[model samples]
Target: MSPSKVSTIAWDSFHNTVDGKPRGGKEKHRGVNPATGEELWEVPIANQQDVDDAVVSAQKAFESWSQVPMEKRKEQITKFKEHYLNYVDEMTDLLCEETGKPRQVAEMETKGVVGFIDFHLSLTLPEEREEDHEKVMLTRYTPLGVVGAICPWNFPIILSLGKVIPALLTGNTVIIKPSPYTPYTTLKVVELAQEIFAPGVVQAVGGDDKLGPMLTTHPNIQKISFTGSIATGKKVMAAAASTLKRVTLELGGNDASIVLPDVDIKKVAPELVMGAFQNSGQVCVATKRIYIHQDIYDEMLKEMVEFTKTIKTGAPGSNALLGPIQNKMQYEKVQTFFADSKAKGYKFAVGAPEVEQGKGYFIQPTIIDNPPNDSRIIQEEPFGPIVPTQPWTDEEEVIRRANNTNAGLGACVWGKDVERAERIGKRLQAGSVFVNSWEKPTPQAIFGGHKESGIGGEWGKEGIKAYCNAHVLHTYKQK
Candidate 1:
């Protein structure tokens, strides 16, 4: 079946999409175009009453949705994926306007969600297990009911749908609450889903700070999947505790990359820099720091600095490869790190050390040359376009420094020999370790944080298990 052009392509943008329909909310707030520093448009804020409508509807729908056949569910989800692709280019346009992402990068995020849906379709719940003696006992996987997905501003579309697809496919309903900074695309996608899904099967609500706690604390929500800073993730966990809801929190990371002496500088420099600054260094797993073997420290730094010359930072609509920070709070937070770096007199190897005032929240990509291990820029998540590099005389010492942080989301190891790289990669204290290139996580791999990074995970069969409940059924011989 084909998607109706009128219903699938058009989005009002001003209202929240709830229970498969558009409606007004308690209040409204305007989102700014980080590229131009102009108000893009006003969006509704869901108050307590609106939240009640969503949860009530979701609970009501769960009665039938949880009973639908898996094949039938897959058919509807496939339709949603097809409709999403049809609307993706338009979604990218809105994403750029609101999130200040380069058009290509934004398109990647929007389309990546489609890829995630495709991967989830290949997955099936564990087959029923039986143990027999005088009787039989079985294990079954069951949907946990209504799920609340709290997405972050960076990669808003993919991250939100990443949770929604798995939850819905597992026979659970979903209520998506994207970060207020970049809410439109996710809401629009959910709005369009009304055509393919039963009312209340998929929903989206946009709002300020209060909305998150309200959704998390809602006793009816069986699970909460959150992606954001470590602090906020902690708050989400705490709030969900009152309801004893299951949670999957993918929090922040101060990931580090180790560059061994034998690797070619030219081949790895560009990938290294891109890994650190993609999405303006706003990614949770983007390598925030680099450790180079002393033998190649100077050469690696030199090549990385020269490569930074090719990156252009400007409006997302322009040919620029990098765009502004998505919001004022994050922009100013990054500025504080910039100021601290300057006060401490660290030497910059690329771009200017100063934060230039612009109409938008743009920061020129800057690199610090071998700053002290204790430097705030190296130790903390700046979440902007600044990075730090340090030299290591011993392999063990460099690994120690990289593992020093409580963050263990992801780390990288670069070496000419693949086996050697794997050896070093395994020693790092991250959930995922890249041996050579810092590529994005594929749908097949499970991703989450260790230590303070996060709890639970996403993608792969292991991660999707968070959305389900395992039950044991017992059978006995009858007379």
Candidate 2:
């Protein structure tokens, strides 16, 4: 398993289909490889009619699938997982090509997709226990009719699985509208899923977001789960309101990574670099804001800079450690953060806006020093690789500033003192936090945000509950 060995699986082309009829959306957009500036493929931008067709398909499937026994459904899903697991190479390559993530990151996420399927299997098949006596009782979990999922581009395969699998496990049918920027990869995965699950039970549709409202507000859909920017997430929520649909949003984050004075920077630096910019900083939980104790700030910055400089950035299959921005808009957005920060008087400690020679949509791994709290780079979620590092004199003050943002998705604390890290982790408003390690969405753990970051989580037993509607049953003894 040499790191240099390039791995790519040849995946079949994805076509837009409805009821086994191959169809194309009203318009089409080109999916480009940001690393090479090459046009990789074109994805059809679905129209209102296309959304209607998909939703109808799902709604129709729910009628029959919802009646299927849970054990039988689990058996079918297990076979789906088997198929999905066998094609890990294809899924990994598709993700790398579409999202511009390095091969290792792609493989990691491919593993995540498999793990998500396994997680749903674990949660959906809770042990059936006998309750009080003469009156037979069964606590049942049923799906919310038709589930609509709007997936984000970063970690598309894994995030899609997080939402789609849970909905399916609960006996609900789903229609996924993948982020057009990275739709093909997920579509291919779903195409494989169609083998075990019926065509309508699990489906994917790609299109311009303008059509999303139609899916959200459709009369048949009972719940909506979305993973993307806060702005877009709000839009989805507003639209779902028309149908009074149950919704779960996994949105934007300006997650802060607090570096306590006694923390080990040598160990922390590499993790922060990966956490912040693993996918060119396109991650929602990317460590955007870093607060460090003044005593160790300078030394930590040196280590962070040296570590960031060592990462190689290039195409997906390259021997590089980092990859290009997923798209041009993201590249431009990263540049704007740089231009605005400098105008507001921030110093660059590691890299600059000007990318290396011949790099395509690739910004150097940047670390800004002591930017003002009010600055856009600090106050707003960067959603890119640009991170602002500031010095905090007091522990309480650091927690206050970290929780100041409307977002509360994730946070990280680094300190050699375990007790101090735990104390700080408790005060943070984020849904998830890691002490001495950066944020990662594990299948067994819960993942979501607080406030504008998101409404509910999307993994673990709690995550499965989001897709199900609970009913209470009471029995009266005969007199």
Candidate 3:
């Protein structure tokens, strides 16, 4: 059979095409392009039955898949990795079209996913680690059966792949529910996965928020990994409690970037913007807030503004530096903060009050100066291209302000002196800190949040542990 492009899938394996079953899965929702407000696609809303079916499928596939040896699982993943890389360009275009992200940003997201598939396969399912029989001590990691993965809209393909692929690599069958806004690209991934794995080994259910709770509460789902808001993360946790399911929650972040007195924001402003507004500030780890030292506050602010002026804000295909804000609600929420901040008394050093281009949700690369710390824009997770910055005198005070929020995802402190930056970075409350530079996610490195930002890590050896269970082999010796 030829590999035909499929953007949707049925809840049951009985149909190779779309499900013709009655419309009991809630209501059909239309996904729109944030850039043009055009109807991109309509995804079937999965109700309780759909979620139940997904869980049952995953659980069934898990029995046989979990029995596969680690080495064999690794080999299958290796083949899937090769096939995934060949399809990166296709995936990139789908991302751009669906998410309205910059072409380059979409490419980077797809590239991360491609690398993630290869990385997890190479890291997790290795042949052997020196077998030890002396102490009756042995460590074998096995899959947690069915994994119900709830992914966010931002970097849909990468985040979904980042979670599901690793779980699949470690022998866990997954039922992924991508955020309704950006399910198209992820559905494409599921289509590709079906060719390599069993029918229910890696399945996707695209629907509203309701499907998530169903999957989380399902008796068969052994693990639940979610990436979204703090409130929702809590709810997911609470729902999974009854089932006693292992849960991993990657939540919100209001990350900070500090520029020490000696460092030049002019030299680092581009990097800061890249880190802050890469996906139009829809990133969980984006530097949403900046706390610059008083000595260089004006200089850094000026440089940031100048650098911001050079950035391109347009539709996805333009290869612009920035893209749409991902969804309608997010765009309006961001616009409200900008409007409210300016109305109350804050200043926009750069960026317009409104969106620059098509009706699609887009925000100018905005920089707000000295907004009140108690203001909603400063205290809350903006999750947009808006960055609120202020000056501080004391190092301790800076750390205090940075850690004021409930989020402790990722933070950065830049300075000419690496030691000084490191000292400050260590003090900040975050999972990962960057001294002088922001480090992108690497396969060998662990990436997750502290506090409310996330419960578990992804993209490393530790990430593999998140998907597996340790077993001890005991052998009796007869003398």
The candidate that achieves the highest lDDT relative to the unseen native structure = 1
What would the TM-scores of all predictions be?
A: 0.97, 0.93, 0.91
Q: How many clashing residue pairs are found in candidate 3?
A: 3
Tell me the spans in candidate 2 whose CA falls farther than 4 Å from its real position. 1-12, 125-139, 353-359
Predicted structure 2, TM vs. truth:
0.93
Give the local distance difference test score of model 1: 0.88
Give me the runs in candidate 1 sitting further than 4 Å from their true place. 7-12, 128-132, 477-479
Q: Write model 1 residue lDDT over 1-479, tens digit each, in one string.
A: 84856743555445687777897765888888888888877788898888889999999888899899888889999998887778777888888988989888887787778778998998888867676666777877899999999999988888888899889888999999988898788878887788889999998888999999999999999999999999999999999999999999999999999988899889998899999999898899998999888898898889989889889998877888899999999999999888888899999898776799989999888899978889999889999889999988888888889999989999999988889889988888888889888847877888888999999988998777788999878888675
- lDDT for each residue of candidate 3 in 165-261, tens digit (9 for 90 to 100): 7887788988888888887787767766766677678887878766777888888889999999999999999999999999888889888888788
For candidate 2, what is the lDDT? 0.80
Better of 1 and 3 by lDDT: 1
Candidate 3: Cα lDDT at 27: 69
Q: What C-alpha lDDT do the candidate models reach, one value each? A: 0.88, 0.80, 0.78
